[model samples]
Target: MATITSAGAGSGIDLESVISASVAAKKTQLQQPITTKKTNTQITLTGVGQLKSAISTFNTTLAKLSTAGAFNKRAINITQDSDDPILKISSNTDASNGQYNVTVNKLATTSKVEGTFASSTSSLITEDGTLTITAGDGNEFTVDVKKGDTLQQIRKRINNASDNFGLTANIVNTSDGKAKLVIDSGVTGAGNDLKISGSTTELKMFEADTSSATPVTGSSMSRTQQSTNAEIDVDGNILTSDTNTFKDKVQGLDITVLRVSDKDSDGNLKSNKVDITTDKSAIKTLVQEFVSAYNTLIDKSTELGKRNTIVGGESQDDGGALAGDSMPRSIRTLMANTVMEPNSEMTGINSIFQLGIKMDNDGKLSVDTDKFDDALDDNYEQVVALFSGENGVAGKLQTSLKEYTKTGGLISQRQDQLNSDLRDLSSREATAADQLEKYEANLRAQYGSLDTLLAQMQSSASYLSLLSTS
Candidate 1:
């Protein structure tokens, strides 16, 4: 029947409502299923991407503890018997756990000397000449004294010279109406003493001779301190250093001597006990981190695969986004297998089980702290091997996880298929819409002709009735 858009249809039927209802039914029949399919496909695709991202995050934990260097963290503790403040110590991984008694005998001293002049502002040098300052270490600098340069002026010249090695000059005005020009070597060591000599008689009074144990005769300056090597007795073995700092003197220990230890009643040097021990806490923390990361992967994956649930006594029909997906299940299985396969070859730690990390039926991990501590205490290296070695848990997971996570892997392929389904559904929805449009058009066209036919039949009957009456 035709739909009567105008009010003149004799059929007396509201065909416009009929045509609209028919079109609505066709659209529902043709397009609803495709729309549902697209929605489900998008959910599945999103679920797969989440799974891949979770796996990638877990891989970071694997990468962190995958090296021997990560196991090289050191914990050094020093305990001293005396509070002499003699040594500041540090050690690296190469240091062994042992006790050493170090008695600092003498700290290295710098050579210093002083030359007295007439007054604080006197022209110490009356004529020009060269004053050569040399260190026993072969560093030297020469200064030219003008005819009337004050003692303070000469001090500035000596200090300002770039090649002055490690020498420092200061002028101290004494209470006896005379000025003292004090020059000291900045370097410390037995043979690095300072020697100041002049080329002319006028500058000779400013000369310093600290080269020998006693200042040489005719040297106008008085020796204040002598350069000496730093001496230490480590467990009855004497060790001497040019400077105060001794690096690797006892394997990985670096020591800087600050002062000589005080002697006891019998003139015996006091000793400071150096304590070195392994830090077992770092390894334990690392193991705990591994447990947490593995459990996270398990927990997230399990959540993704959850089935339908009942909410407020009403059954929520659909499950999680990744429900019933075989690829995620297979991915979980692959990881579970890698976490246990091909046991480690390291001594004592044959597997992760020995290190107190265990997996449950749900693929979640938990640690036994007492057992873990015992393992770390007994065999630290083996514990490192079980987690980070060539055939270890992390190692195997790293190799197996790539099969699903890499470009064109199982996860990628599944996502690709889901996306293709979505694209296909879009095309199907468009086709269904086009078909519904044509069906509505056909109904409207056919129903309009029926209305016209019905109106003509009514008119013929009315004309027939009038003729009979006449």
Candidate 2:
């Protein structure tokens, strides 16, 4: 008789465990959404993008705070005194003669003259015979006088040479039918003393007739120095300097420096302040940028809350409010509270809301243009304090945001934890798979041996039954 006895199946090879393990691994991969290899890259990119956007918003706000018409502290302007008239000779006019002198009480430490002059004779005459004339001394005079020049020719010569000398020369005909040559010194100083001593006598008519038997008594022209630079009060302080660097003399102002004499291109003896007006357009642009950035953040938060992206969703797709949100509710809460809160350290600035900026229904920032302008007009310092003062909104926001994104911050710590978890999970999955595969192979061998034994027993039983029946 053939009997069937139970041989242990040895737990049936637990195929379900292998399948469950595979399913669990797939589920784990899906649940994590980001792998160890890609998590850093995605998070880094997202964090950088958010940081850049925040910086852009901050910059926009800062730009709005800067007033366009604020006077450039470096600017300066130099204007000549209107009350005190400056003496300038008309064209075609010359000094009483080729020899004329002027005197003034106040003297400019640095003085210069540039003009042209002509004389009847070519003989060079120094303004002060005692003072040696040197090139570029502002005192050297060039006399363009040709030989055999007439009285009228002498007048023309002085006019022609007016550029070389600061003085002018002209011949005035008296009622006695005699012409007297006159010279007028263009500048006032001891250096203005004119002397004519050369081989040419044509210019002698303009000199003092000291040799006449009867000494002609007239106001003997003498040279005197005078202050040529204008004085001005700057920042409640009295400062003196050359006209060229007058702008530098001022404490704070932007000025265009100009030369006093037309001959010297390098000489800057005057300065003109440039006109600066408030740039309303720039302010408007800044406001728009801020609004746009704020709106973008709000929109991004909304999208993240609705969708199950790594950055926030609910149920299977619901990453939960915090799960997939790019701009988390916590961050929004921080931003809102920081911008709205008042700081005890800041005296005038209480809140950004005081500056006429408010959030709309869409959770985007908006500015009341007129009210904002009024607030700015009222107290710009208070506005600055509100956003940028000690422990202020902007400062707090920056600190909080940086804490979340900076190295060793929340994001970095989370990433490190995730990476470690992934490593452990990967090792566990590999070990489970290896153990399962070995178990399956051993079960297959056992099943093959049992099948061989069962087949032999069946064959022997069948043969024995047939022989007995026969």
Candidate 3:
């Protein structure tokens, strides 16, 4: 057997030291302290996520409560002013003489006027005296027709010569059984303008020589077709309309009635031109919503900052050690400072502190209710000016919060980094555990082999000594 020196026997590397070193390296690389913090971070993250969700819900609710529907709970009412407002007339003449103009004006309040005219009523002319009536054989009749033609013979003659006259004749039975030949104009205004022409005898028909005769000049008169009552309540008083001006009906407010029939390119109704003025009640409701939201935010912040006792020991931490931290303090400070800070963009909302909202040492807010009410009463417009338009406190706060919590925000970036660290640590720990198992197995095998070799050498030396003594 070859002489096996300690150098040749096995590796000089300490297996325990190698395992311990691998473990330490993994621990350092993995940042193992994070394991202890995982529970704390999870609790804090859950509480923060819940708080963020609550705030989002509160914002949505506040927006809904601040709408027009919330402020104005009354229904809009409409009514027609008068009964006999519309008129209908039919006349018979040439195209130039058939047209007529109609003008509508606001009678009592304002002298605003609108006008339109009929295109034409020339079709009202029903008949002409010069009728070249041809018989069925296509021969013209040489009949001596007087000015006063009985209604019966005219009907018969027109019916017999239907092809030439192009007229429909019918003897309508009256209620008293008296028969009359009625001539209905095929065109709308044709029958309304009956004239006699081409015969001297037909001229007498224009004048009512007999009491029973119908005269030309006194044949038609204009008549009114009245509209029904349309009424609705405006504020507390009843408003009526025949042809109501939209402006007069709504009182001080101007509402445009968009006709859905005429749609724009985007399939939306074209807005009618109108100006609207805000009411006092509307302004009041807006102020109330702002106040309510402000109060709620203050209360929630205070609740989040309060310390509580678990069992007999009082905790110095707000809410709880796991749940509470700097987040609530930061949010409260941000809110207070934002309201107090002066900016060119938000001139009126420069200082909510001036509006009687104040903070305490514990980072909680409170409103001086009486002072706020007095401010609203004394200068309501100033309150509206502070929070109504584009440069309002609520608008600024919304913008700031959106920027802070969005995907690429500071908090979001920090959370991402922490997640990455956690994953890397877990992976390294798993790798270290695998390496430790392999190193331990190799050390056991080497030590077992060395012990077996020492036992064999001792047995051989004892047998040789016994042989030498013999």
Candidate 4:
């Protein structure tokens, strides 16, 4: 209320108190309903937000269950008795459930050629010529050796060439006061072999010919190592690869040959068995996670629609902040329908119950572990179809939940409408506050004028009374 600077000072009447009380009464009448409506709107908005969050989380779990990798996973085991593993292996979900007898005969080797020199800094190449180098799949390029170039300088020139493919050149000390130009293929494999030919006889010593009848050893040159492919025998079927790592050898399998298995005294190859099987425990965990997420969403949604009895005999729905809203009821119906309905498109296991997932009396899911494990053991494909296909439980639930939780969807639209209402209410409240302020000012002005008139009248009455007494 606007205060009067000199209100009722001469009238002996407390008009300020009266005007303040009047303004207060009017303020309550104008503001109380708006306050109540805004409070209710905020509460409902919060409840709807929580429901949307729960549905979004539930949809994530549904996505996890719907993926092919989750249901079609396979586990692998290899014999651990061997000190050095013959090979390391991994498989995808598409891997077959079987055992493989793997015999690693030899690991792939990279081509390494060394060119010996009389001394590290001696100018060995007496002529200037181009050395054409071929590496890995006939990629031919050339490096020029300048006249009077030392072995170390020639090695540096080769190492710095950009077109050298995967060839590396180094000058290694052979411990006889002479350095050797060691050239190695960057990648391991016979296909990645490095070959060199020169235009001059002096540079011919740098040629890499590991398959010579006799070891190509000159006074200062030798072939230290030869390029070779990896060899493995799978149940009498020999498989060879240029690289150490082999992929798609078996469907969905990748094998990296770590080392060659030890041979017996009779030269018989040692073998190991790799067992691939369905991962039942992983499937169980995914199912449990889905159940837990579904239960939480259901419990929260149910609480939002429930009514509670007051402390005394009266009954009220004060417990549900979102009481009488259709969204909660719609959510419950959608989830229940999705779970109970049969997947007509699925041929074998068309319903969740076939996978040993059952809804209890409290509307929560419980899994029968024995039944689930048995289903996984016997009918794994059927179990997978029940939860993952087009008409699968997870697929249907994901589609349905997306309708409610996606942008511009039902829940999103409802929240957007509520936010709009809050914005409008804020504007209305501001306008009401301004109006009430102006109204209180008018009331104070009117009361202050009335008090001045009353005081003047009292002064006249007192003067008349004095005149009559005199």
Candidate 5:
């Protein structure tokens, strides 16, 4: 609607100001409640969002602790009487608790062959032919060397061969201007010995083939090392491996032999005793995390119900936004009550308190570490069943969270309802503004007509008085 620029200007009665004030007063009355409710709804939405996020996080933590494997974690320690452990060991969750005596008889070795050249820049291969190479476990490959190929060139071809076995070729230039081509097995094992055969006439000078374990002498090249497997005696049971690392030999145990155990003065073999036990520390950490997350949710949820004293002004209470709200209040109550009460199916130590998880007067959870440790030591399997079973603490908490955090659940429905309320308020606000504008325009028009008629009547009365006096 267009506002008249000179409203009441012809009569000079200042009717524009009066019309504006009247419209403002009516607008306040119509819009105040809508604005207040929208503000309160926004605050409530924010609070609900915080509460939902906290609960979801806490529920996730509970899920991790509620698993059977989480409680079954094991720790391994390898010890020797007076010397350092010769083997590095690790275990998985499926590993059982046991002590094993391991004696290392031998450690695996890689094979090496060294070929002395007159010079690294000197020609190594005089004829173009393929050089057959064999590595770990009798794996063989071939590299075609061109005629008049230098020491570096032949080494590159051997290193870059596509069908290359686990063999690496390196050229070491000596101080006397001579170079040596050293080929080493990339793996360590008994049958993984490096062998080279079938080269050109000129390349025969560097041939040192040990395919049949027979040493080739009277050549520029010589076999410097022999391939061997790692052998260890575990509790009188002999074990051999191509690599020093042994897997599943002791049932979920991985034994990586670093060195052979040193012998005592009496020439008796010193063995390492590996003791594997349940890792109670892991279970304790999980429980602590769950408690922390649960307390965070409880604190945030409780804040939604707290109210402060107010004296005739905007409520000083931070929770005034969510005051009288049922969803948040009920959620807080459910979480508190569920954790405190016992459920069916989880026998004996059904409640977390039985597991030494205690609650304070202020509704925060804390673990009595000594008591908790004792409970774990005495009733380990019972503790696992209490948290991971069908009617466990985590199971119950997850059920309650699913009701609110699930798709189209309580939180989602509340968000949708708040959005609808905002939309309705916007529509009402627009309608109210239009109505006020129209009301002001009608008032200005009626008052302007009155002012014009009053001025005409006064002018006529003045003229009559002037004529009668004359």
Candidate 6:
């Protein structure tokens, strides 16, 4: 089609239109098939991706149902008898169903000791000495006192020590310019008491050691609080804890003693009753959600693989891209079979339907919430067993769906093959286009040469006829 000396000018023939029509016919013959294949490939890929996404979302919904915690969860209720709750309580899924009467007799304490000083800033350290403090859990820290160190300065040094164990030191200055060094231990329990000792006698006057017989001596130091364990009475059984929280006292229940229970007129410690039971409502809600998700997946698969509808004598609806594909059909059949099949191993409630998961005629799921709740009230364990074990409904569905949706899965591999075909078609189309360009150019060149030959022959015939006439 490039402008050459007009191909039919000398020969008086319209060769340009002929060449154009021939090239058009050749292009249709060579490239139309590739164009059709590429369009179909793109359509199928889009449909498959949408279907995979739907299956993945449904799988996520099944995750909660496959776990034992979803069914075995425990909710607790405690009687608030006193204005101040004696204990703060909670239970996990592992907690047994039972009732517990709990009473907090005595709570744990941390050691608090204070030392008196005649003046807030009086020089206490006459010579170089070391003040050492020790406790359980490898808590041993020392503060080196230099000469002419005041009581307030020593208190600041203890507070600022980087390696100082769990304790705080404060100088509480009295009204008459006298001061007191108060040290409160954060290390809890009786055996884990804080002990302080100084190398010199004058510094020893400020000593306070809970591990020793005389924890505080002289007029300088006094013990305000002693370290003790938390004690509680539960159903005639006494329990002790190093901290305020008494963990596992009621078999998977953590009871943190807030304060001692109020005493009655007869001096009997008031008690609160705790009830632990299976959380049926939460589990039932999870089952209902799973059914909803299951129905959604079925609906999506049907829409994706739907066939054309014929109204009267004409096709009124165009078929889906995946209308003839077995991938979507197989997925729907697998999930539907898994749902409809009754459990052979489980007794009484052998299937999801017994748990009120009803299937429609068109293969969709519906939840009867009341029936499911009633089943939970009567046969909760059987319902849990139907959905949680290795052969459970959710478990089997996940296993089956994994084949189609996992990395390099069946559908993914199919998509990969289709993309490979599309690339091949693209390469072929480019090569064919290049060859056709050359072909068209060659045809124009040959026809232009023929036109010049015909023009030369006409000139020769005209001269020959003139010679004959002469």
Give the top-scoring candidate (lDDT): 6
If both were scored by lDDT, which would come out higher, candidate 1 or candidate 6? 6
lDDT of each: 0.79, 0.45, 0.43, 0.81, 0.78, 0.82
TM-score of every model versus the real structure:
0.61, 0.44, 0.41, 0.80, 0.78, 0.75
Q: Per-residue lDDT for 295-333 in model 5, tens only? A: 888777777756766779866765544666787668867
Off by over 4 Å in 3: 1-34, 37-48, 58-329, 342-350, 439-470
Error of 6 at 46 (Å): 3.7
Tens digits of per-residue lDDT, candidate 4, 1-470, equal 44676668869898878878887898798887887889889999999998988899898888888877567877888874557677888887668788988989899987777766778687877779987877677666788999998878878888787787767888878878777788886666776666677788877777665444243433234567777889888777898888887887777888888888767799987888889888888889878888899999989898886666577788765677677777887888889888999877766677888778888776889899999999889888888888774567888899998998899998889999999999988888888899899888888788888987999999999999999999
Q: What 10-residue stretch in candidate 6 is worst by lDDT? A: 211-220
Candidates by TM-score, descending order? 4, 5, 6, 1, 2, 3
Of the candidates shown, which would achieve the greatest TM-score relative to the real structure? 4
Summed over model 3, clashes come to 20
The deviation in Å at residue 173 for candidate 4 is 5.7
Report the C-alpha lDDT of model 2 over 39-152, residue by residue, as the tens digit. 544554454355445544554453433333221111111233334422121111110112111111122332222212243234434332221112223645545545545556
Query: In terms of lDDT, which candidate is stronger, 1 or 2?
Result: 1
lDDT string for model 1 (1-470, tens) is 44445433567767777778888898889888888888888988998899999888888888777754455555755454445467888766566678889899989888999877787586767778888988785789998778888988888889998788868999888898888889888878888878888888777677776766565456668789888889898999999888998888888788889878867899988888877776678767787788898889887888788778889988787676898777667777887877776463555457778778788888888888999889888887777677775466786787788777889987889888888888888889889988997898788777777777777888898899999999
**Ten-residue segment with the worst summed lDDT in candidate 2?**
91-100
For candidate 1, the lDDT comes to 0.79
Q: Can you tell me which runs of candidate 1 are displaced by over 4 Å?
A: 1-12, 80-274, 309-315, 342-344, 455-470
lDDT of 3: 0.43
Q: Which RMSD values do the candidates have, in order?
A: 9.2, 18.6, 20.1, 4.9, 4.7, 5.6
Shift in Å, residue 437, candidate 1: 2.1
lDDT of 3 by residue, 21-134 (tens): 655675555545555555555555555565565456545544544332333222222221223322222111111111112222211121111111121111222343544322
Scanning candidate 5 in windows of ten residues, the lowest lDDT window is: 209-218
Descending-lDDT candidate ranking: 6, 4, 1, 5, 2, 3
